[model samples]
Target: MKILAIESSCDETAAAVVEDGRTVLSNIVASQVEEHKLYGGVVPEIASRRHAEAIVGVVDEAVKAADCTLDDIDAIAVTYAPGLIGALLVGVNFAKGLSLATGKPLIPTHHLRSHIAANYISHKELKPPFLCLVVSGGHSHIVEVLSYTDMRVIGRTRDDAAGEAFDKAARAMGIPYPGGVELDKIAENGDDAAFPMPHPHVDGAEYDFSFSGLKTAVINLIHNKQQKGEEIPVADICASYRKAVVGCLTDNFLKAAEDLGYTTLVTAGGVSANSLLRRELERLCKGKYTLYMPEKSLCGDNGAMVGSQSYYEYLDGNIAESDLNAVATLPIDQRGF
Candidate 1:
């Protein structure tokens, strides 16, 4: 089946054409990083307008690049929930219009599920019944994948997500907007043990996570240094902070997988692209777990993963009518239309 997918979640407007859910014929994304960077973070209004302006052309490019026309698309898939409402509405409405015009099936997908399906694009051999850690700017979760269309969240953040913590910590250090990547680069030169950040302990939820305290600790350290006219070691702070955050996430995920007797461990979302996390997975999961991570390109929001997931949603009869609208706070497991 050829699925044409649209993704306008957050600041990225993306489109992709996938065949049988595993092969990507074409994938296109127009980033709003430069525009959002000016504000130190995403402005919802700006993101919505940008999605409106980019969706049409992005879809056209995807079709052309995939060597197909609208007539060749078997299904139209879109991320309908768990994103900026306006941004999501643009894609959802555009997709609805296409479905109306072409008489094709419209499939609704969840943003988190799309992230998990990114693995299908890279690791074709990967299947269900694995433990996955999904970490992004807005979410941090450890899920047990029971099947392509079935999953159970085993652990999640009780506070800020790891990516959010990184960005806030970077801002505290006076780093630029979208500072996580920059912080990671600078952290490569610092000592991880220079400042040992404390790990959070959830009372009874051993697999749960908490990064708010860690984020505050970094901010406090930076603020106190400036108040005392002390030099702030940016690299060391980034390194130590990254280590602490990565350690918490890694530990929880590994513990969950071990407790559940899962040998295959998968990671999805933007934070999965962290160099430290990737390195640590290599060192720790070596002889114990088989690790899977999506290609860096798929780590961020994109349509290919949505397309990949739509195939399963399609099999499960998860189709939507023209009246289908966008949802900003839809839960991931609510697969029903």
Candidate 2:
């Protein structure tokens, strides 16, 4: 099936055409990074406005790039939940309109679920019944991919997510917006053991995570150094912070897979693009289990992943109604608000 997917979940307005689920014929994204950079992060209002302006052009580009028209698309898929409401509405309403005009099935996709599906694009042999470590800006979860549309969260963050912690830490170090990427680059030159970091544990929940303390610790350390008229070792701090976060994430991820007897492991979402996380998983999974990771380009929000997941949703007879509305938050296990 040919699926035209639209994604305006955050600061990116993207569209793509995917065949079946694995083959992506075309992927187009319009990013608002430059505009959001001035604020050191994404501003919801600006992001929504940008999405409204770019959605049309992006979908057009995707269709043209795929060498197909609306008539050739079997379904229209869109991210409808767990994102900025206004930003999501742009894509959802546009997709609904397309489905109305083209008489195609409108598939409402969960943003986080689509992130997991990104693996299908790169690892064509990948299938369900695997463990996936999903870490992003707002969510940190260890999910069991029971099936294409059915997923269960085995573990999750109790407070700030790994990506949010990274960004906050980078901001304390004076790094610009999208701090996680910059911090990763800086961390490469420093020793991870240069500074000590906290190893937090949620008393009752073995697999659950808590990063708020770590984020506070890093920020406090930076503040103390500045107050003492001492220079901060930005690289060392980044390395240590990254090491701590990666260690925490990998510990739970591996434990879940081990406890569940899952031989196949996958990582998804924005933070899965982190060098430390990828390297650590690669080293640990070597010769023990097969590991799958999306390409760096596919790590962030995009339409291809949504399109990929849409194929499975279609197979499961999942379709959206005309009154489908965007939601600001929804669990990965839940379909809609």
Which one is best on lDDT? Answer: 2
Candidate lDDT (C-alpha), each = 0.93, 0.94
lDDT per residue as tens, model 2, 120-187: 99899999999999999999999999998889998999999999999999999999989998999999
- Which residue ranges in model 1 land beyond 4 Å of their true spot? none
Q: What is the lDDT of residue 7 in candidate 2?
A: 97
Q: TM-scores, in order shown?
A: 0.99, 0.99
After superposing all C-alphas onto the true structure, candidate 2 shows an RMSD in angstroms of: 0.7
Model 2 CA lDDT for position 115: 96
For candidate 1, write residues 1-337 as lDDT tens digits. 9999999979999999999989999999999999999999999999999999999999999999999999999999999989899999999999999999999999999999999999999999999989999999999999988999888888989989889999999999989989888899999999989998999978899989999999999999999999999999999999999999999999999989888999999999999999999999989999988999999999999999999999989998899999998888865667535
